[model samples]
Target: MYRERAIRLAGAVRWESVSAGDEPVRVLPDGCLDLLWSSGRGLLVAGPDRTAHLSVSAPGERWVGLRLPPGVGPAVFGVPADELRDRRVPLADLWGPTAVAVADRVADGRDVAAVLEEVARGRLVAAGGPDPLGAYLAGRLAAGGPVGAVAAEVGLGARALHRRCLRLFGYGPKTLARILRMRRALALARAGTPLAEVSAAAGYADQAHLTRDVRDLAGVPPGVLLRA
Candidate 1:
């Protein structure tokens, strides 16, 4: 079972899951960072993924996570997003003693989700909050704004924007734009929109284009994901 809800932290979500060990769960690229606690794996951080991550779980294992959106994670972790891309690392690797303290609390059987949220909130506050540019960049790309236009909108030239994107999003603007587009299409398709219409509404040239893009990043066709 899986469930999620918006939390007090801005643009962040709290989620919990009980993995049944049925099959590998396909984790799509969503330009986000997750602070994760798995009963089987202890505490870890899930970095921004450029492609799908197949997570195989042990039956009855429990997990709780706080997902911090895009640019916010770099702030919370005090590391560039690119440094952590497509990787899941033990929290102690980065947070060290701080993460160990949290692990002790988890061992004490506290509400792990709440604890994760508190950790994220504390780090975000100490870092003085997520970069304002992050929200703007993600919002614009999600809305289908062209990359050049977005860079210009933010008073940055092309190269500067690319550098910032790598540091903040783990990818350049073009890749981020593609991932955001496919995610929007996935959302629409999951909502029961017809595939053809989903492609059109998502600004794809056709359903075939959507299929190729989805397969490239998600490692499966849209039909498969919809079934999952």
Candidate 2:
């Protein structure tokens, strides 16, 4: 497995990915936005204009995941998070011409960082926003840093914060928390920690709760992912 720092390219963004076997399975739930362009292998995607579930079962050894930063997604894909709920769009369609251009640039030996900066800036320029809520939620998600008290710290009532988050982040606060928590759990599991300890440390109610979350979000039992 590897973790590489990536920057957005001119007209697009990229994310660091960690993978396993030649044909590893990846399961992602509703939340986050991306525009992926792949040559081969198809995926099963669920959800609509707000949330989505994607399952990739592939025989190909190569997989790349691009995670669009909050506001930047709608600008690139023309499908704002506000418009996406349970819909699943293919990477080819989502990537459009921008993806092709970026790939060509990358292949031409241009600096990835410089290319990403140009891409990001171009999109930001096109997408004008008075997006206070989106800005607030992005900062909150970053600073929340794996805690349930993000709402309280922001001085928002739980219910109000929940609604605001839905509009801004395209997912409820609880769902975001579960996603973050499960992500941490997956890391701990991969690091060889015991399941019970991982569950407690990751703040799940119990091992069973952790298992369920993993199953739902990752489409695999905790045991299976850990061993991978």
Candidate 3:
């Protein structure tokens, strides 16, 4: 089973326990980064992805992860978001010996999710909190606001907005908007909405537009992803 919960920290926590017989998990792009710990892989960081990621695991493999909200990862992870884009790296590579200690604690049966949360909370505090403007921009884009309007609202020009997004979200505002729209469409479809309505409501030009975006970001058609 795969489950997720919104916690008091910066974002959501998810846990997945998979069996060898299960099909590969299709993870869609959500414009977020995850700090993940697996039974076999220890601790690793999953970067913001522009496309879907297929995850396969061994028999009885388990995973606990804390997903950081957009604009929060660079601050908490102490790295430029663009540097980690579309990549998964061992935490030790970024955090050094500190990451090793965290892995050891998880190996010793410490609550994996809780440990990740604690680490994130500490980093957030040290970083003097998340970027308020960046978070607001993320929210606006996710709500389907036009990038130009969002930039003007934030008192930043287009070029400045692009730079900020690259530093905070690992992509430009337009790409982030596309990712968010795709997520919105998927949520509506999964909730039993018709594809036509989903496409329109999620800001796509039409069903074909929705299909193309889904294929581009998720590596599959909407029907396949919805069925999965």
Per-residue lDDT tens digits of candidate 3, residues 22-65? Answer: 67777888878889887788889999999998888887888888
C-alpha local distance difference test of each model: 0.93, 0.56, 0.87
lDDT tens digits by residue: candidate 1, 35-130: 999999999899999999999899999989999987899999889999999999999999899989999998997888888998899999999998
Q: Considering every candidate listed, which one attains the maximal lDDT? A: 1
TM-score of 1: 0.98
lDDT of 2 at 20: 38
Model 2 scores worst on lDDT over the 10 consecutive residues at 43-52
Each prediction's number of clashing residue pairs = 0, 17, 0
What value does the lDDT take at residue 130 in candidate 3? 81
Q: Report the lDDT of model 3 for residue 111.
A: 78
TM-score of 3: 0.95
Between candidates 1 and 3, the TM-score winner: 1
Q: The CA-based lDDT of model 1 is what?
A: 0.93
